[model samples]
Target: MRFQIDPNDRKPLGRTGETVPAIGIGTWRINNYSMAETALIRAIEVGMNLIDTAEMYANGEAEKLVGRVCRIIGRDRVFIVTKILPDRFSDQSKVIKALEASLRRLGTSYVDLVLIHWPRPGISIEKQIQFLEATVEAGMARFIGVSNFGVENLSRAIRATKKHEIVANQVKYSVLDKQVEKDLLGFSIENKILIQAYTPLEWGGVAKNETVISIAKKYGKTPIQVALNYLISRPMVMAIPKTERVERVEEFRGSMGWRLGAEDIEILEKI
Candidate 1:
């Protein structure tokens, strides 16, 4: 099936001036390297420009799969993001080495964004932020960000690193888990930090929900499409939904075409 992209849906990610499709593919559970490669190639052919993975995912297997996909499709068209775990920050040398390893795995000279996978417990937040700044200064990543960071932790990290700012905060946000909206979302927006939504569908809730299904019918779209549109339609937000099916890839690309109107947003918000 052919996919459609919206002209205005593409938005700038951060102060870095990089823009990605409002909706893109998330490559976490794509099991086989070859299969991941095929899915990624197909996704890009259908207009998926943003792909997210982490170094710890499958013990770097996911990064290897992403690298293979980039090799087949060429790197320039994809906005690739991979994360460094907090443990690596304890030793600054390891932080740089981990990024080099990720680059080797992805077969890219530099990643678009490198995030701290999580904030370490009882560690000096300043030092962690320093590691991130050092990585950016070393040319290992274009932009620096974080994931799974609470509001207080994110604020601390931001204050600790005066050299650079956290560009995005990847979080678990869905219609079900709206907790992020209560504080994290608002804080990130006010600080100009892009919020990247993971499991934006709540692991298939939107796909099977009666509300989402009904709304999808009204829009002539799939339940997932309606749900994802509701996400990207919001300010300072982007979603990374994982799927390997050909139809789902097309659906994700289609989700970018139209948008959730005010009423649609209200209905989704109430759910």
Candidate 2:
């Protein structure tokens, strides 16, 4: 299927009636408190208040840094989303317990969203979704979803839910990696599940692309900014790019408040 986004129309969080910046902070590889502290503050100043973290990231040390940054920035100003590791999915059900640990690390009582880190072997989609439903029921998670889920797994996971709806799916999507665009992207758009794009820059690969560079020059924007904005051009999509540098956060902010031209998008489509 071919995609043609207007690029000018700003899509919301998959019809959730919530308003947040199209880009957000990703604390995946950040382990330093001071660097994350400065970076997150700058992120908020530029309207990127969403923060994505996982208990598995740096063995929960990254959540501690995000927790500290949230404290400094005032928690209400930011939308926090954290993932629960797959090992917690089982009959014994350590899911709620794990989310609590993440909450303790995040220094918050309730997170904006909670996701199953990834689908696990021998774990029923029913069980996985049930565990996440428990988090929302306990008032600890405002929404529940999954990450690294393909279309088949995502469909099964959603069907397994009983009480709450699956809200978002965090995936590795970038200009260089368009795997999700094949089927998952279209499905998520139809189902109103927001696709939270991780690694949207392909670790700086887009910066070296001649086409992306030329488009950047036309807009007076950095290649990174063009790449990030390109991801958000899709329906029900947003980006969460991780950076340890404060200046990078400022640069990331430039990705929004503008749209890429359709002609440029056509060239990017070829890429």
Candidate 3:
């Protein structure tokens, strides 16, 4: 009910100096098409315009739904991010085609950001980065990044870039998972790369956590809001939590424009 913000509320999107909402919505395992579309429309209306989808999600059904949402809400109002499967990395032409197919599904000529779903074995990181780089040059994507890349691979990927910078790293980061803090977070901060925190609620695992629930009471927020606030409060980090409820998107607004105290952050880190 409190801590509501303007729809234009934004955070630094890496060192590119561009800004995106501190909280974005993720479309991963969405099944109820109509319900999900309504929630996505609410997300964009409330300023969480970055919609993350992949051609692999629900066998490409997610992108089609996102396309419908874009058509309803106007594609320019949404910053769509999509991914190409690692198997497409084998050939430059395949990589281009993968993004082209994604564009077709999304009903857009280009995505705000495109990434490789994951690193494939036997295929060099150099080649994968090159493929992502090609998407940008081809005008299929505005910016390029990687998903699930660790510090070592991320370092190598950034080095492999020839024309553009790796602006973000979409990774599984949440209070339940502190693995990103070990090294990847630091590397991203030092290089000015955005850390897209997916599964920020630990896939609903935080709902009953006493620690998060207790903190939620302190801020008059829900457990889910506490879970997301904890992630976006960090530097160069944004949370892309998936939800199919319009009410849930409303709850997400409280997660921004506020933060936990140092003591609470320390307590959460121990969780």
Q: What are the TM-scores, per candidate, against the unseen true structure?
A: 0.93, 0.95, 0.95
In angstroms, give how far residue 20 of model 1 lies from its true place: 1.7
The C-alpha stretches of model 3 lying farther than 4 A from their native spots are 1-9
Model 2 CA lDDT for position 126: 83
Error of 1 at 115 (Å): 0.5
lDDT of 3 by residue, 1-271 (tens): 1112222337676667899898999999986889999999999998999999999999989999999999999999999999889998888999998888999999999999998988877999998888888888898899998899999899999899999888888999988898888888778878888889998888789878999999989989899988887787677788899999999899888888777777787788899
Instruction: Estimate, for each residue in 105-144, the C-alpha lDDT of model 1 and write its tens digit.
Output: 9999999889999898767888888988898898878888
Itemize residue pairs with steric clashes in candidate 3: none
Supply candidate 1's per-residue lDDT for 79. Answer: 85
Scanning candidate 1 in windows of ten residues, the lowest lDDT window is 1-10
lDDT of 2 by residue, 198-252 (tens): 9998777889999889999999999999998889888788899988789899888
Q: Return the candidate ranking by TM-score, descending.
A: 3, 2, 1
Query: For model 1, what is the C-alpha lDDT against the true structure?
Result: 0.82
